[model samples]
Target: MTDASSSLSSLIWADWPAPDHVKACVSTRIGGFSPAPYDSFNMGDHVGDSPANVVKNRARFLHLCRLKRVGQWLTQVHGTQVVEAKDDGKVREGDAVYSHEANLPCVVMTADCLPVLFTDEQGSVVAAAHAGWRGLASGVLEKTVATMGVAPSSVLAWMGPAIGRHQFEVGGEVRREFVEHHPATDQAFQPDYQSRGKYYADLYELARIRLGLIGVHQVFGGGFCTWKDERFYSFRREGTTGRMASMIWIKK
Candidate 1:
C-alpha cells in the first residue's frame, strides 16, 4: 500500500493502529473545483452543489487518495440500517456500510454529523457510518459492529469531524432518546444554560459509550469540530453548504 501521507496532506487520516491493508481517511473542504458555499472539495452529490463540480471533486478525491475503485456512497437517512458495501455504483439507502471485499470503499458523507470508520485488527474488513444524533440514538454504531461479522473486541473505530459538544445544541427529545436507551449516556449531554429545554451534546463521548457497550474499546480521533474548523464543511455553520466524506477500504 502507498503511504497515505504522500496523497493526503489536505485530509485527516484515521489515527488508529489499523493494519497496513486497511486504508481510511476523511476529506476536508480543501482542494477541489466547486465554488463558494460548497467551496471546493464537496463530496455529496445530494447537496445543492453543481453536479459537474461534484463529479470533478469526487475524481480529485479518488486521485488524491490513490484509490482505484469507486466509493460506495449511501443515501443516508439518519437511520440505523447497515449494508455491505458493493461496487455497483448505485447509492444505497442506509447510514452505515461494511465490506470484506478489497478495493470497494465504504463511504459516508457528512457536514456536521459524525462520520465513523471501523476495521478489524486483522485488516480483513472495513466499514463507515454516518452518525447524526438520530442515527446515534437509533443504534447505528451497534448495527455497524454487528454487520462487520467480527467480534466487537477485535474492532477499532475512528470518529471523524462533526459538530462538537459545545457547539451542538439539542432538544429534550434528543437527550431523552439516548437516556432511555442507556442511562449512562446522560453524562454525554450537558444542560444548555442559554436555551431552556436544550442541551449541548458530546457526540464523540456518545459514540464511545455505544462502541464500549458492544466491547469495542479501541477508539480514536474525535477532536474535530466541523462548525469551528474551516477545513471541514458544516451544515449548521452554513445552511446551504456541501459535505465532506469519511471513507475506508481494504487495499487490493
Candidate 2:
C-alpha cells in the first residue's frame, strides 16, 4: 500500500463521520483494465468481465488505501443473508459482511442496487451490504447493523451510488413488498401518473426509513444516481454493465 491519494480518482470515498481509523470506498466505472461494457474499472468479476482483468482491477482498488488484508467479497444473492468477515481468501455467499478485525475489509458489489457501508461512533466495527430492492424489503441493512455487534444508536450508515427514484420505476408488487414490511416506506414511493399501477421508488429513502426503525439514524451519503451518472455502473440502465465495489474496514 503506497501513496493512495493518487489512486483516489478511480473511486468515490465514503463521506461520513467515523473515527479516522475507518477506511471505505466505492470503485467507479472509470480507470481500470476491463473493456467494452465493463470498461475500465469494473470491480465485479461475476458480471462477465475477464477474470484476469478483474484481478488487476481489484488489486488497483485495494491499493487505494493501505489495508493489507483481503476484502471479504461475497456471491451476493440479493437477500438478507449476512456473513461474518473472514480472510481465508474465499468468497462467501451472502448479501452482507461485517468485521471487528482491522484491515479485513467487508465488501459488497452492486450495479443499480444500493451499496451500504456501516460503522459505529467508536469505530469498533464495520460492515457493507448489497441492498437491491429485494434485499432492502427483506431488512438487509438491519441485519448488517445488528451483526456489527454495536449499539444501533451509535451505528452510522453511508449509502453508496444507486439508481435514483426518478429512474427507478417499480410495479405494484415491488411497491407492495416494501410498504407491507414498513408502512413508512409508502411515502418513499410516488405514483407514476404516466403509467397506471406503477410508481417511482426511492432506494435511499427506503433504506433510511428501515435503519431508523432499528434506531440507527446517523445516515449520510446519498446524492449519487448510478443510472444517470456514467461514473457508476448501472444494471438497469445497461443490461450488460459492470458492477462497483463498496467496502468498509477498520484500519488500525
Candidate 3:
C-alpha cells in the first residue's frame, strides 16, 4: 500500500491531508473496475452494481491505503441514530459511527448527500456521518458529535463533497419542515426563480448553523459540488449512481 504522502495523484483521495495523527480521505468516482452506472471506484454494495465489481473496487481502495480495512460501515437510513464502533463485527445500520480506537476507520458513503468526518483535539476519537437533508434537519450532526464523548468545542468537523445549493431545489413543504423545527431555519432556503413553491437550500450553511449552535467551531472543507463536478458521483445528476466514501481514523 502506498503511504498517504507518496500517492497524491489518486484524483479521488487527494484533497484531505493527514494532519495531527488523524488520517482522512474522500474518494471520488475514479480508479476502479466497475462498469457503466458504477463505472469506477463504486463503494456501495446496495446500489445494484455487480457484487464482484464492487468487491474489486473496494479491494483496490484498500490496496492503495496503508491502513487496514475500515471497521464499521452503516446501512445509512438518513436518520440521526449513531453507533459505537465495534472491534469485531460486520457493519451496522445507522447514519453515524464513532470510535476512540486507532486504526479502525469510520466511514460514510455518499453520492450527492453530505458525508462528514469528525475528530477531537487529541485525536483519540473519530467519526463519520451520512447527512442528507432529512438527517441534517433531524439532528444527525449534533448526535454524532455528542457520541464522541468530547466537548463539542474541542471537535473539528470536515464537510465532504455534496450537492451544491444551486442544484438542491426543494418545495415549500421541505422549507416548512425546517422552519417548523426551528423558526431560525428559514434563513437556510432562498426562493427558486424557475419554480414556484420551490427554494434552493444551502445545506452547508444549514450544517454550519447546526454545528455552531452546539459549539463545534473548528469546521473545514465545504467547497466541492458533487452535482456539478463530473469527477465525483452525484445521485441527483444520475438517478442510478454509484457512491463515494468519506473516511476518518486515528492512526495506531
Q: TM-score per candidate, in order?
A: 0.96, 0.96, 0.93
lDDT of 1 by residue, 24-121 (tens): 99888887778888888888898888999988878778887788778788898999999888777888899999999988899999999999999999
Worst 10 residues of 1 by lDDT: 1-10
Q: Please report how far candidate 1 places residue 102 from its true position, in Å.
A: 1.1
Query: Measured by TM-score, how close is model 2 to the native structure?
Result: 0.96
Q: lDDT for model 1, on a 0 to 1 scale?
A: 0.90
Between the candidate structures 1 and 2, which one is better when assessed by lDDT? 1
Report lDDT per candidate. Answer: 0.90, 0.89, 0.83
Candidate 2 lDDT over 93-162, as tens digits, reads 9999999998999999999899999999999989999998999998899888888888999999999999
Q: Model 1: runs farther than 4 Å from truth? A: 1-7
**lDDT (Cα, tens digit) per residue for candidate 3, span 42-75:** 8899999999987777666655666675578778
Candidate 1's displacement at residue 90, Å, is 1.1
List the pairs of residues colliding in candidate 2.
Answer: none
lDDT order of candidates, top first: 1, 2, 3
- The positional error of residue 191 in candidate 2, measured at the CA in angstroms, is 0.7
